[model samples]
Structures are given as C-alpha cells and as structure tokens.
Target: MKIAVYGASGYQGKLVLTELARRDIETVLAGRNRARLEEAASAIGLPDAERRSADASDHEALVSAFRGCDAVINCAGPFTSSGEAVVRAAIAAGCHYVDTSGEQLYVKKIFDTFTTEAENAGVTVVPAANDGCVPVDLMAHILADRLEPVEEIITTHVVVGGGGMSRGSLRSVVETIDAIKAGGLAYTDGDWHPGVPARRTAITLPGQSEATPVMAFPVPEVVTIPRHIRVRRVQGLTEAALGDRLNTPLTPEIIESLPEGPDGDGRRTQHFTYVLDATGIDGRRARGIVQGPDTYGTTAVIAVEGARRLIAEPAKPGVLAPAQAYPSTAFLDFLVPHGIQWIIEDAPAT
Candidate 1:
C-alpha cells in the first residue's frame, strides 16, 4: 500500500522512512523543501520513493499531496501550528492519518474538532502515535481493564541516552510552554481540570537500586487515557533533568536561538523505561513497566506499525488514540522484536 509522510526531511520523518523501508511499503516523501526531501530520500536508500513538495500552510497543496495514498504519517511536530492543517488535508483527501504529535493541546483540538468530520469521511485520525504517550496509554488500558473501577493512574518515565535535542523537539517544548500559559490542564475525578505546577518525586527504576528524581509533567496521556478508561485521575512524570528543562520559560526569540536540530552520537544506544501505577477504588494497585529503544526510533516504529494496521484493515472511522486504535497486547507485542518489551506485576489487595 502507498503512504505519504509529511515533513519527510525532518528527523522523525527520516526515521519513519527507514521503518517503512524495512517493512517494504511504498511511501511518498513530502515536505516544504524539495531539496531536503530529495536528499533525505537518497540518504535513506529510498531513492525510488515518490517525492512531493507540500507546505503545511497550504491546505490545497497538502490535500493534493495526500490524495490517492492509503495513509499519511505526519512527522511534523509542535502540532499546535501545523497539525490541524495536515489533518484537514488528510480528511479532505480521504486517507487515514497518523502523527507523532505529543502535544496535549493538539490532541484535544483534534478530538474536539475533527472526530465527527473524520467519522463522516470514513477516515481514522490517530494522534500521539509515539512513545510519548502510546506506551503509557496502552499500559493504562491493560492495567485498568484487568481491574474495573480504577481510581487513579500515574505514569513516570526516564530517558537514558546520549542524543541531544533536535530542532523539532526544541520547537515542541516552546509550543508546549505557550499552550500551558494559555491554560493549565489535567485530569481530575474523571474530568478535565486546572493543572497544578509539577513537583519532583524520587522513585527507583526497576532492577536499579539508586533512586532517580522525577517530576509530574504534562503529556498526551492526560487527554487520551480518559477516553477509554473510567479513571478518576491521570498524570505523567518525566526524569527530573528533562522536567526542569521543560519547565524553564522560553521566549520565541530564545527558542530560535537554541540548537536548530538534534545530533545523535552514532555509537550511543538510547532507551527508556515507563512505569505505570494504577489504583483501584477498593485500595488495590497494579504496576506495569515498558522498555523500548530511543524515543525517536520507537516513535517511528509506532507510526509505521500503526499505518500498516490501518492499511491492512481499516480501523473504525473517527479520531482515535494509539491504545484505542489497535489491540493493546497484540500491538505492544508486535514491537517486541524492534526493542519494545513490557511486564506487569500485580499485587493482592491489602
């Protein structure tokens, strides 16, 4: 099946192309820059892949680019700016949609604004199709589904790798801070509520004795988890170092001054672990841990696999989350060979 990847010249887009090539699926490398798209396609050994120049701001051009493709994977980030346009284009072009967006605002906007239209058009729009919240969302679904009437859930994660920030990641942070300023938000008592400033907590990583610092940070899980599970509350936390960096204030000028793109240490192997703890209203709790390759690589895997599923068997037409779009266990297991693994340990009620 043929697919299109927007922002094909960007970092995430490059990884997605690599994964699609591994799966032997035809793809269209599309973006605003013709030169970069050609360079990226050749660098990735996809010289024969189709190339289309489509600016995110030009809805007509984007629609033209998406037309006739089975699916479109949007690798562009800071979705607050370009996400809506791409989704509109995909819907207009009658193609399934997937994206690596981690912004809660964008997810909310997508669900709130596009669900009905996408449903009417027989299109599937899956947002946050990445490690940012897919793992946490799936873990929450697995644990909560096992024990009904779950009261709360807390997801904590730590990234252990040598790669520095990419341009897209840096821009995503800038946009997140701007969204947070517009209005603080989180889940409470099974509802969206005003968010509180995040604080740090010390937790020991599985199989490690030393306690690492973490802090409650905003993630897409806060918006997606409630869509399926009847949880009273949900929050996501990240390593203290990353948390502090995200919390720092940055002006548009300052953001423009930061590194323009990410440079990975070729030799370093990056990985991450996400621990999800769920509590039942009856006072019982369950914990699940997921480990996977570096964030960018895992994101590519998720997006490509998700697209494969969509093309193989079209999902129910509507805006869906990663966990909701596919079977939880099967989908998670599909990535095991690609460095994704998980284990759940449940404790008896006290």
Candidate 2:
C-alpha cells in the first residue's frame, strides 16, 4: 500500500517513515520543506517513494499531496492547530487518516466533527495513535471486556526510569499548557471534569521493591474508551515528577532552544510501564500492565502498524478511537512482537 507521511522530516515522522519502509510499503515524504523531505527519503533508502512539499495550512496543497495515497499518517503536532486541516484534506482525497496526537482536546474534536464526514468518505480517522494513550485505551477494552460489568478504570503510567521529552513532544505540551494548568481531566457520569489534580498514591510496579508514588493525570484514553466500553468513570495517572514537568509552562526562548529531533541513544534507554486497574460494582477487580519503548518509537511503530492494518482490512469508516477502529486483541497482539510486553490478572470480589 502507498502511504503519505506529512511532517516526514520530524522526529516521530522519521520513525514512521522507517517502519513503513521495513514493511515494504510505498511511502510519500511530505512537508513544507522540500529539501528536508528529499533528504529524509534518501536517509531511509526510499529514494523511489514520492517526496512532495505541502504546508499543513494550505488545504489545496495538502489535498494534492495526499492524492493517490491509500493512507496518510500525520506526525506534526501541537495538533490543536494542524490536525483538523490534515484530516479534512485526507477526507477530501478519500484517503484513510491517522495521527500521533495525544492532545485530548484535539482528539475530541476529531471524533465530534469528522466522524460523519470520514464515514461518508469510506475512510477511518484515528487520533492518539501514540504511546500517550492508544495502548492503554486498548487495554482498557481488553480488561473491561474480560471482567464484564466494569465500573471504574484507573490507569497509571511510569516512565520506567524516566526520560526526556522529544522536541515535538515538548512542543505539544507547550501548545496545550492552558489545558494542563487547569489540571488533569477525567470522565464521570457522562461528562468530562477538569481541575482534577493528580492524586498522590503508592502503587507496586512489575519489578519494583516498594510501592512508588504516582499521581493521577489526564490522558486521551479517558475520551476514547467510552466509545466502546460502558464504564462510568475513567481516570489516568502517571509518575508525579513527570506529571509536574508536563504541566510546567515553557518560555518562548526555552521552546526555541529545544532539540529539533529525538536523540537515538537517549530514546533507546527510555522505557515505560503502564498499569490499568478495573473495578466492578460487584467488587471484582482486574489489573493489566504494558511495558514498551519510549513515546516516539512506540507511536511510530503503532501508527505504521495501524496504517498497515487499515489498508489490509479497512475499518467501518468514521472517526474512531484506536481500539474501536480495529480489532482490540488483534491490534494489541500486533504490538507484542514489536516489544510491547503485557500481563493481565484477575481477582475475586473483595
């Protein structure tokens, strides 16, 4: 299948291009920078794939760039500003669309505004195709489905040993500072509530000695899971330190000085552990944990994989969450061999 990667020269974009090549899929390296797109194509040894310059702000240019491609994977962010335009272009071109946007507000917009348009165009629009929340969203489905009659889901993410955010990731955080400062978000009683702070609590990790302090934070999963599961409450948690850093505002100078791309060695050394606990009204509980590579690598692999599956077996057209857009276990299983380690456990009512 032929896929076009907008923002092809950026950090996550490069990784997406690499994985697409490994799968033997044809690709188009696309962005506003012609030289950089060509350079990226050459670096990935995909000299034959198309390289085109198209700015996200130019609708016609994006439509032109996306034409003739089966799918388009957008790696550019602060998606609040750029994501909808790309989605519109993809729909206009009748191409399936996916993006690595973990921004909750943007993600909600995709589902709210584009679901019908994408369905009419016979293509799926999937957002949050990243470590930010897709895996956790899928796991929520797996565990909730297994337990049956799920009531509440509490998910915690630990950056294994901690790591630095990629420049693009930092930019995403900076772009959404207002939302972060309002505090973490959660879903309860069919409405989203903001101004929720990360509640400090101790939890045991897979191979850890003592319980570690983790604080609740907002995640896109809180928005995506309800599309499939009927849970009444969903809450996200991450390490307190990282959560604090993520909510911290960035100055214009600080944003300008951030590295333009991910450090290869630095990314490899970074790993993550995500744990989800589900409780039923009957007092039964289930827990699951997923460990994987850093955010950029994980997002790249999953986005490419999602594209591959969408091409091979298309989802019923619409804007859907990662889990809703694909077979839950099948999609989750696809990540296992790619270095996603997971374990799910069940317990009787307490």
Given candidate 2, what's the lDDT at residue 296? 78
For each of the candidates, the C-alpha root-mean-square deviation to the true structure, in angstroms, is 2.6, 2.0
lDDT of 1 by residue, 85-182 (tens): 99999999999999998787788889999999999999999988987578778878999887668877777767656556567877886767755443
Candidate 2 regions off by >4 Å?
Answer: 160-163, 197-200, 243-249
Question: Which residue pairs in candidate 1 collide?
Answer: 166-262, 167-261
Q: Model 2: clashing residue pairs?
A: none
Residue-level lDDT of model 2, residues 1-350, one tens digit each, is 89999989988899999888888889989898999998888877888888989898899999999999999999988799988999999999999998998888788878889999998999988888887577888888898887667788888877555457778877887888777555467878787778765544877767889887876665788889878888887877776666667646687688779776557877777788888888886788988888887667888889998877788888889988878878877878888887888778885666
TM-score per candidate, chains pooled: 0.91, 0.93
Best by TM-score: 2
Worst lDDT 10-window in candidate 1: 260-269
